[model samples]
Target: MFQRRKVIGVMGSGTQAHRERVIPLARWIAEHGYDLLTGAGNGVMRTAAEAFVAVAGRTGISIGIVPGQATARGYRPRPGYPNPAIELPVFTHLPLSGKQGQELASRNHLNVLSAQALVILPGGEGTRAEAALAARYRRPAILFGAAREFRSFPEAFERLATLEEVCDWLLGVMR
Candidate 1:
């Protein structure tokens, strides 16, 4: 029998928290048969993609929401970097430039409508924006690791603990 895929939005940054939590958690999501969603780029997005691929072995699908328009060309592996666990599905829409400026406002805007639930890891302004958007649409949001304090909506769920806690919460949602 076919099962409905649960697209879990993982909002995080391309920094330390991502190195510690976001990457591993995303891998777990895939191992458990859930699809992973994120803004396509480096840091958390890259880490999650790697982890998902690691867990899925072969049949993983990693979908990315590009800030601007995707090119007719598909994703090309950047030289000297790890290939994504699965193919990169880019949803393009330009918003900013540079490292920090690469923040994709459009991706944040569409996050809630694109997924069943959002799991926010620690991040900067961009991550906070995605979490806020999820709440604005009343989508179920669980804040894992950091970003729990910045949570400003009643619809938001916060659990600052181990990855096991995060997994338990997500599995509960699945059930």
Candidate 2:
């Protein structure tokens, strides 16, 4: 019997790592034998991937969806992609992100669609856009952050204040 390993996507700020929350969450995902998926950039993405990779004897690898655009030379990853922690990098030609993250040109679509479940951290517009896509796609997703960070987000996402709640929600959804 063959079974594919599940992938857990973690979305958040490209500038703020939120290490206090992301490190433990990422390690938990790795320890549980689930692949870690992210935007493949800095901040939360990098932090999560780094933490996931650091876990000893973990079965899952860090998977990063890198955003880029076609140039005269060829396609190139956008600045700060893959962040050294990604064991597998899925490069894309879609360059749009941030305010335009919901657009077709953004790799956020793939990030939201590919994962079995998602964990959202405190982030900016780009993270919000990913959250929107998760809701639109009807994926099992939970926001792991303070209420103020996601006040304007869709009501479908349950905001969790503690890591324990986030882990419980992840276990429920991933199951």
Per-model TM values vs. the true structure: 0.74, 0.97
Model 2 pairs whose backbones collide: none
User: Candidate 1's residue-wise lDDT over 1-175, tens digit each?
Assistant: 9977678877777453456787678878887777877766667777887777777363547777665543578543333223254365654454432333324445566655677777877667667667666767777777776545545433456755678988888888766
Q: 88-148 in candidate 2: lDDT tens per residue? A: 9999999999999999999999999999999988788999999999999999999888899
Instruction: Score each candidate by Cα lDDT.
Output: 0.65, 0.93
lDDT for model 2 comes to: 0.93
lDDT of 1 at 86: 35
Instruction: Tell how far residue 93 is off in model 2, in angstroms.
Output: 0.6
